[model samples]
Target: MRILLAYDGSPAAETALGLAISRYGDDELVALYVAEVDPTTYDASAFGGGTDDVPDSDEAEAVLEEARERAVQEGYELETAVEQGSPSDVIAEYADEHGFDQIVMGTHGRQSISEVIVGSTAEQVVRNSPVPVLTVR
Candidate 1:
């Protein structure tokens, strides 16, 4: 099966990667890192703050490299990609556009009011994804 693993270098994401590797080692796996671009017009730089929400190219590369290394350690060749957009949208769209059979990702598992107000990426992806999404916490 063709699987797309949404990787963000988080602990949960690492767990998801490990699970995918162990269960679907021989499947076609692609680790996708979505660099969430801030859609707001607010500029943090003007207020003496750095724009840390949006990751740079180097950071994206580093995350992909880490995923690749982990897959290699498991004796599997993994494909990787970096995309810029809302994480949930990019993940779901990429899976559909790339003809993936399923998507595997990690969830923060936050149940607080803030999480309810602003849903987590995994929740959004689960709601909007074209294929089945397996979320590992």
Candidate 2:
């Protein structure tokens, strides 16, 4: 079985990655980070200024890099992808196109009010995914 792990370096996402490794270490593992490009905007700051030390672009790349290194250390050959698109759509499409047996992701655990306004990516993926989706809190 192949597992597709959606990683963004959030604590929850890191937990999901760990769960995937622990449960399906013997299977094929693919880690993906969607860059979440906003087609309407070009200002980099739009993606930053959230109290994170690094810029969003740098942080995204850093997280992917760290995940690759961790995978290597864990003795698994990880297929990683950095893509430009909406997170839910990109993740679901990639998993389907690649024939992944399962999809693993982490949720920010947003409450009803925020979810109603912005919608949760995990919720969207779970709803639209072709395969089983495991969401780590």
RMSD of each: 5.0, 5.6
Error of 1 at 99 (Å): 0.2
Candidate 2, superposed: residue stretches over 4 Å from native: 41-58, 109-116
Q: Provide the TM-score for each candidate, comma-separated.
A: 0.83, 0.78
In order, the Cα lDDT scores of the candidates are 0.84, 0.79
Writing each residue's lDDT as its tens digit, candidate 2 over 8-105 gives 88888888988888888889988887776555664446656332322365666788788878877887667776765578888999999999999998
The residue pairs in collision within model 2 are: none
Clashes of 1: 0
TM-score of 2: 0.78
Clashing pairs in model 1, backbone N/Cα/C closer than 3 A: none
Error of 2 at 39 (Å): 2.9
